[model samples]
Target: MNNDESQPENNKPKYKGKYRIDSTRLPAWSYASNAGYFITICTHGKKCFFGEVVQGEMQRSPIGVIAQKLWYEIPNNFSNCQLDSFCVMPNHIHGILVINQIREGDAMNIRIQEEDAMNRVSTSQRGDGQRGGVTGLFNPMLSKNSLSKIVRWYKGRCSFEINQIYEGFGWQQRFHDNIIRDEFALDQIRQYIINNPINWESDREHPPHPPL
Candidate 1:
C-alpha cells in the first residue's frame, strides 16, 4: 500500500526513556553504505493525485507526468544515486534506488554530541520513531549523501514543483524503505513494482470499489 499507512508498532523504532534508542534499521549497518533500497512514498491521506490505472495501464495525469519526470532527474541531482525499476502509482511510488560506491568523507555517520542537557537526550526520546534525528531534531543535512537525505531531496523537489500548480499536493511525512539484501529480493521487488499497475484493482492503496 501507500507509505501513508501506518506500519506495525513492532516494525517501528522505539524509544525507552531518555538514553536508549532502538532503531528499526539493521543493527550495526550503515544506511549510507552502497546498497539497493526499495522505497515507497505516498501522498498525504493516500489521495490519488498522480492518476488512475485503466485497463492494466496507468493513465498519467499532469501531476503524474511531473512525478515521473522528477524521478528520472534524481540521478542528475545526486551523483551517487542511480535509478532502477520505478513506477508512479495512483497514491504512491515504488522505486529501486541504488547507491553506488561512495568515496571517503562522502557519507558521514551522524553522531550525537553530548555537550548540553538537550544533547545528552536521545533523538528519539520524543517517541516519534523518526530516523536520523540529531539531538531530538530531524536534520537531514547532518548525514550527507545518505538514503534519507536522497529521499528528502526528491520529496522536497516534488513538493516545490507540484505545489506551484496543485496547492493541495502533499506527501506523507515519512516514507517506507526496505534495504535490498540479496539479488533475489531485488528481482522480486522490481517485478512487484512493474506489476503494481496491472494489479491495481486489488491493491490496498486503491480506493474502495463502487457498489455493483
Candidate 2:
C-alpha cells in the first residue's frame, strides 16, 4: 500500500501562505442569469444614520426614507429587475432582488450615465414609453439590466440625493449577496426580509448605539 496515495485528499497542503480576503461571489458565476438574489447593504461603519428601532420595529428617519425611496425605484431604473421583500433598517438593509425575463419590443428606450455628471441624462422614453429585450443586451457589464450595474446606479442616486441634504451620506464599499438556488430557499429569504424589522434587536446587522 502507498502511504502517499492512502492519505486523505483533505490532508493535502495546496499552499503554505497567508490567505487574503476572497470574493464572496461564486467563481465563473454569471450574475446576469435570471434568478433571485438575496442582498444586504450596510451604511458606512454600520452607523445608525437611517433611523432607529422602537418597540421592536424599525422607524426610518427622514434620511432613511430617502434610502427606501431609491430602493423601490430600482425597477423604474432597470427594466428587467423587480424587488421582492425589502426593509430599510437603521444602519443596514435586507432585500431579495429578482432579475426577471423581458419580452421582445418591450424596450422603448435606454439610458446610460457617463464620467461627466453634467452630461448625464435621466429620460429613456420610447414612443410607447415601455422597456423591452433587457437580456438581449448581451454585455451584462454595460447592460442596463445587469445586477451590479443596477446596484451601482441605486447607490449613486441615493447618495446623491441624501448628500444634497445630509452631506457625506454613504454606504459600505462592498455589499453582500446570496444566490437563491431553489423555490424553497427563495421563499425563506423573502420571509426573512419581511420580518427584518421585527427581528431588529437580534439582527447581526443591527447597530450598537441602541445597545441591544
Candidate 3:
C-alpha cells in the first residue's frame, strides 16, 4: 500500500469528529453580562420569505415589516436590552443587541413604581389568564440578558406572526453571534449591517431557497 493509504484520517490536527464539533461560545463568559453582541439569524433553509433587495436597498415584504416592527419593540418587552443597527434580508437578519444590565432605580423605588402602575391600571386585567397576550414560554431557563433568550423570543414571535400569512414559516436551527470587545469592533459590525443590502447579490446567503 502507498504511504498515504496507511495513514489515519483522525490523525489530522484539526479533526474533531465525524459528526460534530464543540460549541462556539467563550468559556466562563456570561451572556447576560453587560456587553454588545452581533447576531445573525437565518430563515428555515435560507428561504427568501422576509423580503428582497432592490437598487442596493431592502424593500420590506409584509412579513419583513412585521419582523422590523417587533425588533424595535424588544426593549418594550425586556427593559434591560436595546437594539442597534438591525437589518432584514431576504433570508436572514443582522443586528446588534446591547444589554444595559438595567436602568438607575433603587429596589424599593422600583417596587413602588411597579405597585403604583398596577393600582392605576384597570382591575379587570389583574389576574393570570385574564389577558390573551401573556403566554408561557417553553424555555424557562431564559435569563434576562441571555443571547439565546433574545434571539429565541425574536424568532418565535416572528414565526408566530409570519405564519399567519406564509403558513408554516420557520427559522434555522440556531443563530451565530460574536461578542463586541470594543468600540472599533462595534462600529465595524454596525457598518456591516448597514451595507448588507448593498452587498446582497454577492452575499453567501444569496439565491435564496424556496419554502422549507
Candidate 4:
C-alpha cells in the first residue's frame, strides 16, 4: 500500500480519473504558512455515505461519525493546526483550518512575531488551537506541514478506516479550498458551513434522491 493508504493490488477503486482536475492552488503561496483556509471534500461520485439531513439536522452514519471525529483529531496530529467551523453533510464536509506556522516571505520577522506570540501564551490556555514553539518554517520536510499533506492524511486515514467494513470506500480525487484573507470572509464561510444541513435541499452538492 502507498503512503496515501491505497488498497492492495488485488483491490482497486471502482472509479478512475481522480487526478484529472486541474489544481486551483496558488503558485506563489506557501500552503504551510500562517493563515486560515476553507476546505470542502466530497465523497466519490457524490455518494451520500455520511447519512442524510433530516428536519434541518444532520444524521451521521457510522462512516460519517468517523469523518467528523477524525476532523476534530487533526489539531492533535498537527500542533500548529487548529480547526474552526466544521460540518459533515450527506456527501461532503466543510471546515475552516488555521495554520499558525511562520509564513514563507519575510521569514525572519514572522518567526520573531511567532516567538513573541508563543511567549505571551501558556500551554493550557491555547485551547483547541494548541500553539507549539515557533516552528514549521525550518521543518526539514516543509511539505510535511503543507495543506496538501494535511488533506491527504485526512482523506487517506478516512478511507483506510471506512474500508474496513465497507470495502472500496473512496473520496473525490482532490478537494476544494479557499484561503481566507480576512475575518469577514472567515465569518461568512463559517455561517455557510453552519447552514449547510438546513439548506441541503437546495445545495448544489446535494445528491439526487430516489423516487418515492
Candidate 5:
C-alpha cells in the first residue's frame, strides 16, 4: 500500500466549518477601514505546539517560531500598517494592528497619529447597520481595503511556509478579528495580548488531542 493510503484520512477536516469563507469576496460591509483591529489566529484546530512554559519562560516551538516570523513580517507586508502589540501562545496568537491613513473629513490639520487614526472610526459604525444604522454602519464606503482579503493572504502565506519548514503542520481555515473602537478598548486589548502567555494553561482552545 502507498504510504499516503496507509494513514487515516479522518484527521483532515471534512468541512471548512466557520473558517472557509472566501476572504477576498467578503461582503464590502465587512471591510475594516482606517482603523485598529485586534486579531486572533489559531493553529489547525488549535494545535498547541508553539511552546509550553518551562521555568517561567516561553521556550520556542516550531509553531511559535512561525508565529514570531509572521508577527515581524506584518509591517513589511502591509504598508501604512504598524504592529502595536502581539503575543504568540502555544495554540494561538493575539495581535494589535493599526492601519494608518487619514479618512475623508478626518482632521488633516493635525499630523496622523497611530492612536488618532485608530479612533477615527467607531466599531458600532463598522457593523451591518440595519436597525437605526446598526448594520449599515459597516458601509462599504468607509473601508479602504478588504480586511478579509488581507488576512487571508497573510494566513495562507504563513501556512504554506510554515508547513514547508515543519513538514505537516497547518493553520485553521480562518482567523478572528474585532475592531477597536476607542482608546480604552485598544488599551485593554493590548494588555490582553501582552499577558496572553501568562494565562496559557487556562486557554480554552488548547488542543486536547495530539498527532500520533
Candidate 6:
C-alpha cells in the first residue's frame, strides 16, 4: 500500500517519450538558436521522497538546493538569456527561460577579450577603458545570445556538483521543453512556473493514494 509502489499490472510509460529529449544529445542548432523555451525537468524515475511537503510548504531536498542555485545563476552566466520565472518542487522543476541572440562584435565580445587586462588594473584606475564593465558582461537586448546552451551548461554543472554533495544524485536522462511561439503563450507559461509550488499538493505526479 505504499505510495511509491508502481500501479499493479499497468504498462503505461512513466514519461512523455514524445516530448522528452536528452539535453546532452541535442544537436548544435538546438543550442545555437535564439528562440525562447520553457523547460521542465524531473528527478530520475520521478522519485518523490527527495523532499517533502511540510505544513503546506515544499521544503527543498538537498538536490533541490543545487537546482535552485543553478537556476538563479542562469541569467548571469548567459548574458543574452533571462530567467523569467521558476519553481523547484520536491521532485521536479519548471522554469521560463528566454533566449536572445548575441550579435557579433558587440559589447559581450569586447568584454571577453578585456577581462584579463582589466584584472591587472585597479577598479578605480581602469576608468572608462576597463574591459569588464557591466555593459561588456551583459547584452541589453535579449535576442542576441543562445538560451539552450545556457540551460544545458547550467544543468551539466549542477549535476556534477550535486553528485559531489550526495553520491548518485543526478537528473533524469532527458528533460521536457516547449518553445513559446507567441507573447500570450509566454505569459501563460511564466505564470504557471511561478505558481507551481502552490499547486504541488494537487499535482497528478504526486504519489498516488493507496488502494483499499
Candidate 2 stretches greater than 4 Å from native: 1-24, 105-143, 210-212
Report residue 81 deviation for candidate 6 (angstroms): 1.8
Which of the two candidates, 1 or 2, achieves a greater TM-score against the reference?
1
Candidate 4, residue 53: Cα displacement in angstroms equals 0.4
lDDT at residue 77 of model 4 (Cα atoms): 84
Q: Which regions of candidate 4 deviate over 4 angstroms? A: 1-24, 102-142, 210-212
Each prediction's TM-score against the native? 0.72, 0.69, 0.69, 0.71, 0.63, 0.60
In model 1, which regions exceed 4 Å deviation?
1-24, 102-141, 209-212
Each model's lDDT comes to 0.68, 0.63, 0.64, 0.68, 0.55, 0.56
Model 4 lDDT on a 0 to 1 scale: 0.68
What is the overall TM-score of model 4 with all chains considered together? Answer: 0.71
> lDDT at 18 for candidate 3?
19
Give the clashing pairs for model 5: 125-137, 128-134, 128-135, 128-136, 129-134, 129-135, 129-136, 129-137, 130-135
lDDT-based ranking: 4, 1, 3, 2, 6, 5
**Residue 131 Cα positional deviation in candidate 3, in Å, after optimal superposition:** 32
Question: How do the residues 1-212 of candidate 6 rate in per-residue lDDT, one tens digit apiece?
Answer: 11111112223212221222222222112333455677776767666524766665768777777788888887687776776777787777777777664657554654543463344445524356543233222211222344434555766887788888777666665565666679986777666665555666666556554211
- Whichever of 3 and 5 has more TM-score, that candidate is 3
What clash pairs does model 3 have? none
Model 3 vs. true fold: TM: 0.69
Output the worst ten-in-a-row residue range by lDDT, candidate 1.
13-22
RMSD of model 4, in Å? Answer: 12.4
Q: Candidate 6 has which clashing residue pairs, if any?
A: 100-142, 100-143, 100-144, 100-145, 101-143, 101-144, 101-145, 102-144, 102-145
Task: Kindly list the per-residue Cα lDDT of model 2 for residues 117-197, writing each as its tens digit.
Answer: 112222222223322222122223544466677777877898899999888778887666667789987776666666666
- On residues 82-121, what C-alpha lDDT tens digit does candidate 4 reach at each position? 8899999889888888988643554565556446544544
